[model samples]
Structure formats: C-alpha cells, structure tokens
Target: MKKIALLALLLFLAAIGLFLAVVWNGYEWHQKLTVTMDTPNGPLSASSVQQMRLSDKRGPWNPPEGSGVSFTLSGEAVVMELAPGRYLFALLTGVPSLGRLLHPKMDVIDAAKLLERGEAEAYRSVTLSRRDYPLLVTFGDMNDPASVQRVDPANLEASFGPGYRLQSMTLALTEEPVNTGRVKKVLAWIGPHPELKLSPPTGRTSNIPFSRRVGEGDFIRGKT
Candidate 1:
C-alpha cells in the first residue's frame, strides 16, 4: 500500500511539472513584437493615431503549429512618411494591429482583424474627422503615380480601411496646400488612409479566444 501511494504521488508531481513548463513557454513565446511603417505622410506621429490591441491563444483563430501566429507574436504601429515634396508610403509591418492593413496576406493581424477572428469581442472602433492630423492630400493621377496637379483636402481625403473601424489621429495640414508641386508628388497613394487615432481596446486577459472576419478601414472606399 505504501509503495502504491508513493508511485502515485511521483506521477502527480511529474504531471504538475509538465504543466508549469508548458505555461511558462507559452508566455515567453507569445511576447509582443514591434515594427514601423512609413506612409505617404510624415511618420503618423504616434500621438496623432488611435490604436487597439488584443490577443487570444486558443482555437479556430490561431495559426496551425509551425504556421506562425498573429497578434500574440507581434505588436504593430503605422506611421506615415508624408513630406513636402516627393513622398512614398512604404509598408510598415509588426505594428500590433496596423500590420493587418498593410498586408492582409501576412500571418499577422490588426485589432480589427483580430476582432473578426473573435479574438476581440469587445473591440470598439470610432471613426473621427480628418481635420485632426496635420497633413495635406493631393488626388494624384493614378496613371503617373507621382503627378500632382492640385491639392485639395476637400477632393483631398485622409481616410482609413474601406470598412475597418480603425480611426485616424489628427495631424496639422497646410491650408491652401499646393497639389501640383512636390506636395502633390509627396503623399500620393490613396487607397483610403487612416491615421491610427488611438491604441486599440484591450481584453482583461490573453486567454480570451476568438475567430472570424472583421474588416477595418473602409476608409479607402468605405466612406464612398
């Protein structure tokens, strides 16, 4: 009877040890990642953007083992590189949620995408006015890619995803801004731009599981 009890106790201890090891590794492996991106405008100054962050470890939302994870693996931030003349928006990845906007094909996701996956059930996004961010927009000729004939924030737009709740932060723009000159050439791409107004909402716990398809930034065409 004593031998049987001792063996059982040993097995229980081993099981607990294994459990702890798994937990520790999970926490370590899921540590957040950070990255930067340059858009047609100046670095979408961090203070001028809205943000949302959340993650879920289990389930239909998570990538298959060895497939690479999303939110839990990286933190995303989107910054525009708009300039006075001749500016190009380079894709910025690893920003917690903004990454999803740059490349949906990538394994990662933004706050809204995670919400779609059911990871962020309480996720709430608000659409604000473009008057907030300091920037100017020129409806460039898609044919030239860099040809700017006029600058019109009215014809000018600073929108976000075509449908995502993602909000844009406010930045100062040049009034009566020029469009045909360098200002026009700079900040060219216009697939709906969003200024990332604030940090995305957060869940109380990481274990909050999720899965689904929630689109962000109808900003590109969402408003139209």
Candidate 2:
C-alpha cells in the first residue's frame, strides 16, 4: 500500500512539472500595432489589426508554422504580414469573418531594416474589372507589370465600386503593449486567442474610396 501511494505522488509531481514547463514556454508578450494607408480618396486606416507574435520556443519549433500578423481594412483589403526574421507581405480581399481571398503576388518587406532606414517605398498599378460580382480589384507591381499573376475571376471577391480608386498609399506602424503585468500576462497565456478579431461585413458599402480611373499607378510607402 505504501509503494502504491508513493507511485501516485510521483505521477502527480511529474504532471505538475510538465504543466509548468508548458506554461513557461508558452508565455509571451506582444505589442499591438496600428496601420494607416494613404489612398487616392484620402488616408485610410485599418479598422482592426493583429498583434505581432513572438514565441519563446527555439529552433524549428519557434513561432510554429503559418503564424504571423494580419491587418483588416473592412471591405478594402486584408494584409497578411508573414515570415519571422524576414517578413513577406501578401494582400487579400475580403473580411476576417466571411473569409479572405488571397492575392497571388507576395511582397517582401524587411520591417526592422526599414525602420532603421526611415522608410521603404514600392510602386504598384491598380486594375478593375467587371464580373458577376460588383467590382473586381487587382494590384500589380509597376516595376514588373508583365510578371503580375493572372488571377481567376472566381477567386476574387466583389467588394469595390466605380468611385473606388487607390493611387499612392503610405503604411505606418505604431506599437503598444498588450500584455504587461504578471497577472494579465498569465491570463493572456492561459486563454490565448487570435490577435485580431472582427465582425463580418454587412453589405456592399464602400470602405475603401478609390478613383474610378483605370490602369492607375500607385506608390506604397512604409514607415516605422
């Protein structure tokens, strides 16, 4: 009977140790960043943004897979900020709740390096087409217009309209702490959730106001 009790105690201690280890490795602090973009109509800012996530795990386990930040600008676009050390940027159309459609083109942006450099700039051309949906919006790299991917009409979401036009835009990032205190950090670690949570779209409202002009070129400038 004594041996059985000792064995049970050992098992309990082992379980406690494992739980502490998981909590320690899972504990992380994140900062919320706001985004602002310059458009043809005016400067448009993302209504919701996901916090930048960093994990305590090392090696291949670090950051897990497909883990990164995202910014949702209502009916405008969804920007997925991916790649850890070297960031890769992709723009999608749609909202978070309804589901976002990915754009074939992906842009690489070294945010930390750009922060040191003061700013980063890229030129792009915007195109619009008519489909079963209201409007189809497409963006291409002006530097290499020929290389732009030909997206299938079925893959696009009907979001924009005639007045919608994007010429030049600037993206700015400002970071604020999300988990600071010990109690708050522990609570955050225990009940982890997605960095950005937003409601579904209501109707065909124009969130991004763009010019009706076709084949227009735009500048994408970023600042830390």
Candidate 3:
C-alpha cells in the first residue's frame, strides 16, 4: 500500500514538470500592429488576414514549426513577433470575407526596416476568375526534353472562366498596438526553437508544388 502511494506521487510530480516545460517553451513575445485597406469607398480596417509567411536570416520560418510563432487577430489588428533577427514579413489577403473589392494580394516587407520607419504601404492590381484553377502552369513534353515552358494566366478556361474581374487595393501597416494587455511577452531564453526536419538546400530547388489543388477555403479552414 505505501509503495503504491509513493509511485502515484512520483507520477503526479512528473506530469507537473512536463506541463511547466511545455508552457515555458511555447511562450513568446509578440509585437502588435494594425492593418488597413484603402479602396474606392474609403479606408477599412483589416480585422483578419488569410495567411502570413516569415523569413529570417536563415530562410523561411513559418508558424508553429519553423519559428514556433503565429499571429493572432485582436479586434482590428494582428499580434506577432520574430525571434531576434532581421526578417521578411509577407502577408496574404483578399478572401471572400473581406468582400469583392479585395483580391488575392501578397504583400512582402522588410520587418526590421518597417518597424524602424513605423509604417509601410503596398499596392496591388490583379484579375481573378470565378472558377477555381491554377493561376500559373508549367509544361514540358518528351519531344522537347531540354525545353520547358511556363505560363501565367494559363490558357485553360477552367482556370479563368467567365465572371472575370479586376481588383485593385492598397494595404497599409502601422506599428501600433491596439491592445497591449493581450500581448504575451516571454523571456528570450525560454522561447521555442525551430522544429524543421528537412535539411537545408545545397544549390537545388526546394519548392515544388503539390499535385493537389488549394483554394480560398483551404486557407480559411486551416486545411493547408
């Protein structure tokens, strides 16, 4: 009976230790900023964004894995931060939720520089079709082994069917924190490390598209 009680206490202590470790590693300091879109009507706040990509001095450092960091939408802005390095911050917007005025736009900015400047702006104009298909395509034939052709706005009508329209918008980023209380500031020593499994590239292409088709739903649903 005494042995059983002692064993139970050991297990409980071990569990508590594991939980504390997880909390320590997961915590991080996040910077906050507001996003706004300028359109024909007027300036509107960007409550949420579709996707965000980050690249540090080493290379691509995506959320929850590469950098173990992700952005959170708070009211009318986003909260996030990098792990003490210069980085390129890319944000993708133009989902159905934002309305037709906004189209798929990828805005890339130098994070450190933008922070120092206090603001940054990006402009975009793109044509989109009603149907869902690949916007870009690569083609090659056995007869032309050495020749490969790439096409943008691919010829396939399915890729660009009727209901085609053009969209133009401007996005602005300001280094302003709306809700300071929501920001989580963790110590640098306890931050999580990158969990990348693949080895770094050695003069070879590392980006290859999957055979599957990805759409707006995939982005919103967090399926991709």
Candidate 4:
C-alpha cells in the first residue's frame, strides 16, 4: 500500500512538472494578441473563412506547426498568437461570385497572387511592439484558418460554391508607433492600401506594468 501511494505521488509531481514546462514553452514561443473584427453593418460568423496567410516580405507562409502564428475563432472574435515581428495578414474568405477576381487552382494560394487577382478578402500590416509585450489588434474579422472548428478541404469548393470571393482589408497600430516611411513602402508593395493614418500619441501615463523612463529621449535627441 505504501509503495502504491509513493508511485501515485511521483506521477502527480511529474504531471505538474509537465504542465509547467508547457506553459513556459508557450510563453517563450509567442505572445498572444486579441483581435476583434468590426464590420460596418454587423459581425459575421468565423465559418466564412477559408484560410489565412502571413508574409514578412521574404515569402508567403502559413502558421508553422508548433510555434508560428495560430488563430482561435470564438463566435465573432479571433485571437492570434504570433512571435513578435512585423507581418502582413491576408484574410481569405468566401464571396458569392468572382467576376473580376482571379480564381487560382491550388490548395495554398500565394499572397502575391491574391494581390494580382484583387481577391484578397482583407489585408493588414501589423507590427508587434516588444515594449507592449502582448499587443492587441482589433479590426474587421476575415476568414481565419485557425478557428476551433475547421472545414474539410475536400468539401470547401462544395461548401463555398465555385464563386468564393476575396475582398476588403486594412492596417492599424496599437501600443506603439512605427516609422512612417516604412509603413508607406510596405503598403505600396502590398498594393491594397488600407484607409489608415498615424495619429498623435495620447498623453496618457500608467505605472502598473512599469514606469516610463524619464529623460530617456534626451539621449537620442536630434539623432533622427
């Protein structure tokens, strides 16, 4: 009886250790960002999404298996966890018809093709601020690939019909400001420009997370 009890205790400790390891790894892998979709008229279901693509200007890519950006579709909200970096988000969704949009015949569509075809449902430029830790990006939701429930690829054509459409996209910033020149260049390269402009920083202060450094700007004054 004593030996059985000892084994049970050891198993319990092992489980706890495993759980902690997972949590630590997740924290190190990527930061979580909350994204809320805003439609002019109303919110739509996540099921409308077909796939999502990300680009860092090197090449288009999908969420890597264990440690790349992934999405969670909860009702009208989609949360994405990604390693901190600048990224272009392409939202692919279904539309009733594609009169002018190019219909590519492939499983994974390249982001460039989406641009050339003018079929991208939504496009957004995101820069994850290291200072803000986990950044929050809220905008209109598009078709997300990482929803809790996914549609079978075999049934996508049947589900969306032959006229699935890709349209609408935008870009915005939160927590930190980015270089204006860089933003312009990126937007021009992406082709579909979102109706966004940099706004003056709000003069708000907070100390709960950490105090803002005073006289820090003096060090780099007149350098830029």
TM-score of each candidate?
A: 0.21, 0.25, 0.24, 0.17
- Model 1, 1-224: lDDT tens digits are 99999999999999988655443323211111111223434333322222233333444434466233323312112223334332222111212343343334755434334433433332233222443222222223333433322222332233321221222432111112111122223323333334431123355466421111111121111121
Q: What is the full ranking by TM-score, best candidate first?
A: 2, 3, 1, 4
Give the per-residue lDDT digits (tens) of candidate 4, residues 1-224: 99999999999999988665543321111111222222333332221122122222211222234334222111111222121232222222121111112223532224333433444352333332222221112112222111112323223223233532212222221222211232223223222222211222246664321112211111111111
Give per-residue CA lDDT, model 2, range 98-153, as digits (tens): 11111223321233223223332311211222221112233343233222232233
Alpha carbon lDDT at 182, candidate 1: 21
- The 10-residue segment with the lowest total lDDT in model 2: 215-224
What is the per-residue lDDT of model 3 for residues 1-224, given as tens digits with 9 covering 90 to 100?
Answer: 99999999999999988655554332111132233323334443322222222223222323345443233222211222211221111122222111122322422223323333433232122223433211222223312212222223223223223432122222323333333221112111111222221123245355533212222222122211
lDDT of model number 4: 0.26
Candidate 3 off by > 4 Å: 19-24, 28-34, 49-218, 221-224
User: Residue 57 of model 1: what lDDT?
Assistant: 47
Provide the overall lDDT of each model, using Cα atoms, as 2-decimal numbers: 0.30, 0.27, 0.28, 0.26
Query: For every model in order, what is the number of clashing pairs?
Result: 67, 3, 0, 6
lDDT of 3 at 216: 20
TM-score of 2: 0.25
